[model samples]
Target: MASKVIHAIYTDDDILLQAVKQVRAGRYHIAEIYTPFPVHGLDKAMGLEPTRLAITSFLYGLVGLAVAIVMMNYMMIEDWPQDIGGKPSFSFLSNLPAFVPIIFELTVFFAAHLMVITFYMRSKLWPFKEAENPDVRTTDDHFLMEIDVEDHDVNQLSKFLYDTGALEINLIDNK
Candidate 1:
């Protein structure tokens, strides 16, 4: 089976935003948009659901904090109790101030690194991944919008895109 899609290219981000709004207002479904840089408020403009990555990051941070606490307690208090600088090592609670920096660093490190990995995995991006943009120009200065052509009149869609200030319009058939 072959599916048809229209690719509309725009040179400016503002123009692309307006086009997206107009397309949505016209009840047309936009499959995706590609831009060289992040466009502010694009997710809201496209009606995309809110992301849950922040919650995941918080959970990762908590895990890191817990690991740091356990490791510090075992190494500094239980495993080998040592008074480094007149600070008592027998009680973990009394020496918690000294471990604050380590705990903070580990929490930030785990959250950042794990969040990046999660994003990559969620987006299916990895080493040797092929480019998915339909037009190479979209990787540079152009923005590309993909609209599904299911049961819609191609000519009308093209004209509407043109009226929305698309630089170039292309119809693609994917089988």
Candidate 2:
């Protein structure tokens, strides 16, 4: 089945944000938005759900912390008991203060790297992937809002978008 969509382009982010809110209030379903840069509160304006990446980051950090603790304990306490500064304490619990920095660093490192990987995977972004934006100009300076016009009147939608400050509007049949 073929579908038709409207691409509304805006020159500024502020206008785009307001247009999104107005369109949603008018019961129009927005397909997606493309912007040159991140617009603050744009997701909220578009009524998008909150991301779950932070929770996953915390879990990754915990795993990293556990790995760091176990690796440190095995290497420092069980494998080779180092008598540093003539203080020979072959116990992980007793010498935990000395491993605090390593634990913290590893936790942060794992969380940061894993979060980036997760984001890339979730967004389906990878090497050799083709660009999906309909307009290349959106990548430089324009903000675009795509609207599905499956059952809606294209003329009415175009008028509504134009009234909402869309700089340009184009109706395309996505077959």
lDDT winner: 1
Off by over 4 Å in 1: none
Report every candidate's CA lDDT: 0.94, 0.92
lDDT of 1 by residue, 1-175 (tens): 2398999999999999999999999999999999999999889999999999999999999999999999999999999999798999889899999999999999999999999999999999998999887889888999999999999999999999999999899999987
Q: Which runs in model 2 stand beyond 4 Å of their true positions?
A: none
**lDDT digits (tens) for residues 25-131 of candidate 2:** 99998989999999999999989999999999999999999999999988988888889876556688888888899999999999999999999999999989988
RMSD to true structure for each model, in Å = 1.4, 1.5
In candidate 2, list every pair of residues with a backbone clash: none
Residue range with the least summed lDDT across 10 consecutive positions in model 1: 1-10
Instruction: Quote the positional error of residue 136 for candidate 2 in Å.
Output: 1.3
User: Once model 1 is optimally superposed onto the true structure by TM-score, how far is the C-alpha of residue 2 displaced, in angstroms?
Assistant: 7.6
Candidate 2 TM-score over all chains jointly: 0.94
